[model samples]
Target: MLTPSKPFTRRCFPAINVKKGVVMVGNATTFYDGDQKQRNVTDLVEGAKKANVVLEARQVAMKIFEDYTVSWYWIIIGLVIAMLISLIFVVLLRFLAGIMIWVMIVLLIAVMGYGIFHCYMEYARLKGTAGSDVKLTEIGFQSDVRVYLHLRQTWLAFMIILCIMEVVIILLLIFLRKRILIAIALIKEASRAVGQVMCSLVFPLFTFLLLCLCIAYWAITAVFLSTSNEAVYKVFNETVCDYAGKTCDPETFNVTNVTRLCPDATCQFAFYGGETYYHKYLIVFQVYNFFMFLWLANFAIALGQVTLAGAFASYYWAFKKPDDMPAFPIFSSLGRALRYHTGSLAFGSLILAIVQLIRVMLEYLDHKLKGADNTFARFLLCCLKCCFWCLEKFIKFLNRNAYIMIAIYGTNFCTSARNAFFLLMRNIIRVAVLDKVTDFLLFLGKLLVVGCVGILAFFFFTQRIRIIQDTAPTLNYYWVPILTVVIGSYLIAHGFFSVYGMCVDTLFLCFCEDLERNDGSLERPYYMSPELSHILWKKDAELLKSSESQS
Candidate 1:
């Protein structure tokens, strides 16, 4: 019995339940049931690490794309393309000047002919429309009488005398070409020198004044914004609504009734039984309108000054002649100057006009929405108040930071004056020392290309890009890549041109400095050494001595 008990397997343990409903037939320790699903330890850890890596990669890619999109390379490439286009246009314009003069003559003749015909038709129409009792004068008779009367007037007589004097001066100029050319050259040289000095001194002062103006504008804006009286705010809000549409409760107005009164549509007086918060808002609006009007007027005046100054500068440069000036070169220079000045003024005027129109529209909205008995009168009064307010504020603002602007203006003026002086001196030396053809062509090429490119690039980047619609939800995701490429190309081109310009400036500066130091007087060379001495300083004294006699 004892042996039998020992041999017995001690009744097999009950089958253990394992995960996935499997039975464990052997060891009881091998099988167990748990609430959580089983998974490999290695797989769980690896999956978590992989997810983190993916998230990090996405963040890195986004940052990299943003960085590349805004790089300077794109800006430079855009500028170069603009310059090339501008140069071509300028050259074409210069070539067409002669043709333009002829075209103008033809246009003038046509205009005169049209004027005569218009007068005749008006006279005939008047006679036909007149009553039987009223006697109508003949067109030719009326025209003749008007002309005779004009001729008899004092101003007209003076104008005729002036015309005769101008004709006489022209005849003198043609007969005394050599003397005229010499006088012009001398005058141009003097003007260039004076301009250089003024630019160095006066230009800086002007820049300082401009900076003062900007500061004054900001200070005034801040003060206006701070005023407790809600008139300006009301006006601005109304204007914004009128132009942009009253789509939602404007955060600017802070009017709660917008939602309560007009639950479905925009909060207008018609929707609120004319008892809405709009009236209270209008009072604030009027005040704002007044200041905006003043700001616009000042902007217009500034624009006018810029335009007139540019025109005067262009005229001065255009009319001035050199002793050995080539006709084509002078013509080209004149054309380029005219085009640049005209384009600058046109662009500036357009921008200002748009701003003015916006201001006017805001003022108009304020007046209209308020239901003032006399809208026009209210508008005029608001305008006057705004002007007064702006003037006082501007003066105060300028007083606060006058010194800073003055310093900036002084520095700018000095730089300009130095440049002008250098240019004048260089030109004088060039005329006396260097061959005209080489210098003229070189100068023309630089001016035409650089000036044209800068202007064109400004236009294209600022304007053209705005028109392209990239059909993407986010700008950075799609357009950024395209922009990066364009900008990179532009930058490369710009860098090349900039390097060339730097070289030229360095050479010119070195030559001028050497001439000044040596007191070479009129015998100095117009250009500095061709070598890139600035890049690597080597024997300054030897370089100076070499350049001294050459100048």
Candidate 2:
């Protein structure tokens, strides 16, 4: 009998057969192309890896493999030890997230319960129903009191609905919590480890950089304000204002009310959302607001992204081989990112800017073209704009992935993007599942954190306001503290969630490389992680069994 076979790793097998360095079992290039049963290249690459074969020839690829396979005996020992230690930390954080979720659920329930109590209180207070014929003046309470009562009714109804929505969302999270935890299990643990690196290394460096940026921005603003001819023009000239106006300056620099007030709808206010720079000096304010400040903000954001991406990628790199953990991985990664990938970040930002500019043009054209009489022309314009809009979003996503790849490989933007795109295409379904699951879990975590904070603020401030059983007299103003708590909680949650998201992206890229490059056959094997090993182990087993049965 004749049979076709594929590579599958077995611990007892040799890495290289004596006959040739390359092991040949069958025609490996040919793949069946049935839509119903077509196997993915990622699976095939993964299958080949199981048999301990190297398909890639890049030096960087081998470097990554060597990093995983270094000091084999000690590496295994280190992994065992690290697993024991990491398990404790993982459990602690996982417990925290779980406890937070339950707290949010309870808070939502409390809000609903409070609303129900208030509804009964209001109903009980109504002694005698007034007829529709009764005048407003006939009501016993003052107008202010009546108005407050009406507002109270509205608030109770809104709160009840909101609380119900919150409860349903929390319940849904509870239902899917298990799957969500499993999906992000490894990444979450890694994030806890990465936190140590960020705190020790990344945060200080970034904060310093941010301070420098502020100083530089201030200096630049000063220069522009002094030199941008629009800022300082002599308005006191008799030719300009019949009544001598000395340099139409405001109490503050480059800000003043328009001396020549036009009709009702024409001139703008000096401060606030000034529609136009009606005042000459206001041009400086407008330029700073629209152009220089916007660019500086974008630059800072791009810088932060590059720095963070590099640090997270470094953590992933260190994680690939735990035995060789660097003492200063964060600093190491940051230096490399600044030196090598700054250009890549700039390139990505440029792409983003161009896409955004195109979007702005489309929006402006949309307004201008809305009144056009030709139906077919309008339809064409709409289609063109929609296409560009989608393209803009795709470019943004592509640019982000490119930055990750650049962080990993120290490659240029275009090359990194191309490689990342191809890798994703090869594992499209797997990537989609991981991306969606990870995003959902992180998002749920954010909502849980914010909800808990909001409720805590509500409980604290409500008690302090001295509620005397008549809706707290100041319950209407409780939003101030709640809103503040929510904003602060959102910022905190975002900080935590972003680290996890970056780790997920970095780890995924590492896994893609792991599946392609490393074969876990006993003679020359280093597994990605025990969790990942366990995942791939079952697939390897099933393949081996099938191949044997066929033979």
Candidate 3:
């Protein structure tokens, strides 16, 4: 049985190569499939998943590609309705813009007038008999006239001169009207672009209600912290408390801190028993509520993202073809997200949350190692941190695109992600170009919105301040309004810009899908909305009639 060249067959992987007599191929890592071909579980699963995704993608392509009625009656009716609505909206927007411009001018004038009034008060106050004893309550807690006693005529003179300088600067702005007009022109263009997809942003108005819930929850959490910290410290005395061995008071224990209040014998005898007090308080004060917030927050984020994706996808389909655009697709999308995709949304969100948690932990570790003196060690740690940070960002981008596919194809998050990733990889260069362009435009739009809002809010706030300027010495950090304006502008800008961003992403996906499934040549036309195809590929639109003929 044994020849010189013969080798004995021994045990292969028992798990993978189930049959003992079968020769192990390669490293014996693969098993025979139903077709008697060597395959791995990963390969099998991926095959099945990708197959489903392809089918789902085909279903989307079919629905969007199908030819609809070109009947004259529907066309005329839709056009007339759209034209009327457009005219009404344009007129209303014009009126609103005019009103807002005038309102801003009036507010600016009022702020300047307050400055003039403040100058007058300073002038009068300096000349008064009690001028030296005039209590400047703003200066300090010495509101008993000592602050006023320190007020000099030179200070008053300086204040008056400052007011005059401000007035002069305002007057000088007339010479810069041309520059202002140019800026306004740019703003107008951005606003027009924003308006093109603003309809898609409507759903965010309702979804913001969910954001409100998150805010309320945070407020409650803050109150709990303020309420709990004090009570926990005052109610419980510093004792040899260890609940695991039943040494600590049961009544004092919070559920999250059960381990602390009821400690194991090991911790009870540890030298670090003193650390337990703070650890227990941290559990009661922070740990319990934080995890609950994460769960709620994750759900909210998932639902919000799905809603946005669907709205944008519907908009992408309906964008240029007003006739094909349904009455309100946001409602349809919300219905789909809530009814069909809730589970997938949850699954995707959980993965995102896990990655986010790891990133946070890494960040904490990064902070802990702040002063690490070993250069090589520091470099290695930095590289490790950078790797994970980039990974998080990449995952976020992938998930966003995946959600778009989910909205369109109604696939699970994992399947959608795989489809999106593969499609992107296949056309990486084009995707890169499109992504760069979209991001730049969005950044500019956000800048325009935030800059304008901040200026408006600043003037409005200043106009509301009393004219006396007596509060200058006590002015709330001088930058309070600036800070408030920046934050508010950022939030509003994000809300508006997010919709446009979604539109770009959704449209790009649709465009890619169109290219893949349909030959844009004459006999095989694009499945994209009529207006989109015409506008994007102007000269080629003549192919439409031929496509219809073929169909």
Best by TM-score: 2
With candidate 2 superimposed using the best TM-score fit, by how many Å does residue 231's alpha carbon deviate from the native? 7.9
lDDT for residue 456 in candidate 2, whole number 0-100: 49
How would you encode candidate 3's per-residue C-alpha lDDT over 50-161 as one tens digit per residue?
A: 8877776676444333312212232233334333433343333333433433344445445556556665675566665555544455454431222443465535655677
lDDT of 2: 0.56
What value does the lDDT take at residue 313 in candidate 3? 62
With candidate 1 superimposed using the best TM-score fit, by how many Å does residue 363's alpha carbon deviate from the native? 7.1
lDDT of each candidate versus the true structure: 0.38, 0.56, 0.56
lDDT of 1 at 162: 45
Clashes of 3: 5
Runs of candidate 2 with Cα error greater than 4 angstroms are 1-181, 195-296, 319-321, 360-389, 461-478, 522-527, 535-551
| Decoy 3 TM-score against native | 0.50
CA deviation > 4 Å runs, candidate 3: 1-199, 215-292, 318-320, 371-380, 456-474, 521-524, 529-531, 534-551
Model 1 ranges with Cα > 4 A deviation: 1-76, 95-216, 227-551
Model 3 residue 494 distance off true place after TM-score fit, in angstroms: 1.5
What is candidate 1's local distance difference test score?
Answer: 0.38
Ranked by TM-score, the better of candidates 2 and 3 is: 2
